[model samples]
Every structure is written in structure tokens, then in C-alpha cells.
Target: MPKKKKITPNPSGSQLHAQRISELMLEKKALDIKIIDVRNITTLTDFFVICTSESEPQSRAITDHVNLTMKTEGHASWHTEGYQYLDWVLVDFVNIVVHIFSKTAREYYEFERLWADGTITEVQDEV
Candidate 1:
């Protein structure tokens, strides 16, 4: 099969943006943060920022912080979903997508398992 075309408008910038989002997630005390690099695996997006919160409120807070922080960086989310339920909220930028999920929701979904082929980086801060 022919190699698939990658959608990398700015790989470096997208990586940096994903890092920033991870930082924002950390700021909100989101646990088990993982940034999955799916560039070589798929053309869906450059990175997937996944993090888990303790509860619904925590999940919403993480999403809000990421959304606002990204906006301040002059990068608005192209779209967002699952805000109504707060179990798993997705903040989508064109190059990076942030997943804010509650502990239960995250465990139930097991998103990382599905993307095991991708390069996964777990983010840890002393905060």
C-alpha cells in the first residue's frame, strides 16, 4: 500500500501547542496526562492530549483552563464536544485535540489502548 499523506502544517508548533495544553491540564491538577503523537500513525491530527480528572467539576475545569489558555495563546479551538455531560469533554484545535475525561469515563473508554501504536508521552510536573 502507498504511504499515507501526513497533515502536518507545522509539526514543531503543533508539538509545542500540545505541550502547552498538557501544562494547562497540569495546572488544573489533571492526573495521568498523556500526549499521544499520532502523526506517523494517522492523518487525523498531530497530537492527542489526554488527561483525567477526579470528578465532573474537575473535568469541566480542565477543559475550561485549556480552552482559555489556548485562546490567550492566540489559538482558538476549532470545535469542542461532550461539554453537556462533563464525563469526557474534547477541546479541538486544528492541529491538537485535548481530551478532558473524568476518572471513570477515562477508565471506561481506555483511549490509549486503542492508539497503542502511536508514540505516547506521559507529562509530569512538580506542580
Candidate 2:
């Protein structure tokens, strides 16, 4: 029998923020949700929350929820983009950048493949 290793919580708090974002995405029914820890790869952000939406409207809804939730926590985006078309809406917090994409847009962008250097964590949908 193999002994199971004890899991420890991350002390930096970024992990919590990442997880919260993932959960929120799940709530909004985002597909293929994932978290990428990019601390080592770049100074741009600590983490990236990437997910796909069924359509442009869903992408906007997901972005809105994330923006509103983060605002309630006193954190706001340094800059946001792609809302006009909503094919890919990017909500950029300094520490966390969220990429919410429509299905076709997500397939074209392939952000996961681009950021392969980062530690990728796939988030499962909540029951």
C-alpha cells in the first residue's frame, strides 16, 4: 500500500484567489476551466484563469460576474479588453488575468499551448 502525501495549503493567498475565480467560472458554467500559475514564467501576473464560454453572451456574463465579484473584494482590473466583440473577453487584474473565450475563439487562441511553461491546473466542474 502506498502512503498518501499530505496536501498543504498555499500561504501566498494567490492560490486561494485562483481557486475562487475557478469556482466563480464554474458557477457561470464556463467550460474547460483551468488555472495556470505563471509566477516563474512571467512577472506579468501570478496566475491565469482560462475558460471557454458557449457564446459571446456567455463570455460577457462570465466576465461581468468576475469583475463584480472582484470589485466586492476591493480588487479591480488594471485593464480589460475584447468586451466589444466578446469573442474573447480578458479581465486583467494585476495578480490574475482571466481569459474568457467563446468556443471558436478559444480553439483559435490556444492560450494553454502558448503558456505551456506555467504549471497548469485543470478545474473540475462543481456538482
Candidate 3:
């Protein structure tokens, strides 16, 4: 078997963006917000912030909140996807990627399983 590559610590920018995204998700009442460092497994994105909203509307709201908050805070996304369906919304901030999904959709995709090797950090929202 080929040797496994080492996972580098997340860069400052990636961590900052991940925190910001997590905060926004919390503000929107997103459930189970998690930050996964996938830099070691794939270079496609440095970090992934996954969260689930209760419904389609909530999912859209969560994504919108993150996008608006980030832009207002002077951090704009490089691109965004899956807004039309509202089942899952992906906001790409270059270093950090935000995924806002409905509960069912989140379970179906199972991104956690796909990136099981990455370091998963649970982010809780203080009520």
C-alpha cells in the first residue's frame, strides 16, 4: 500500500473563515454545525463547515445569513452553488466552504462519512 500523506495544520485564513461561517450558522439557528479539516485528504478545499437547518426555508436562511454576514464583514465568496434547490447550499470562501443543508438532505449526502479521516470539530451555539 502507498504511504499515507501527512495532514498539515489548517492555515490562519482557513481557521478564521471557518469560525466566521460557524458563527453565522449559529446565528441562523443551524443545527449541529461542524468544522472538518479536509486539507490532508483533498486540496479542493481547506476546510468544510457543515450544518443543517430544520427545513428548506431555514436552510436558505442559513446560507443567506452566512453570505450576507461574510460580505458585510469584508469576506466575499469566490463562488456559490445549490441555491435554487435550497436543499443544500454551498458557499465557497476560497479557503473555507460552507454547507447549509436541510436535515434530510444532510443525512442523505453523508459528507461526514466521505471525509471521515479529517479532524472533525463540533461547534455548538450557546442558547
Candidate 3 lDDT, tens digit per residue, 36-85?
99888888888999998898888888888888888998998888999999
TM-score, candidate 1, is: 0.89
Which parts of model 3 are misplaced by more than 4 Å? 1-11
- Per-candidate TM vs. native? 0.89, 0.89, 0.87
Query: What are the Cα lDDT values of the candidates?
Result: 0.91, 0.89, 0.88
Worst 10 residues of 1 by lDDT: 5-14
lDDT of 2: 0.89
By lDDT, the candidates rank as 1, 2, 3
lDDT of 1: 0.91
Model 1 spans with C-alpha error above 4 angstroms: 1-11
Clashes of each: 0, 0, 0
10 residues in a row with least lDDT, candidate 2: 9-18
What TM-score does model 3 achieve against the real structure? Answer: 0.87
Question: Per-candidate RMSD vs. true structure?
Answer: 6.7, 4.4, 6.7
lDDT, model 3, position 53: 86
* lDDT tens per residue, model 2, 6-53: 999754777788888899899889999999999999999999999999
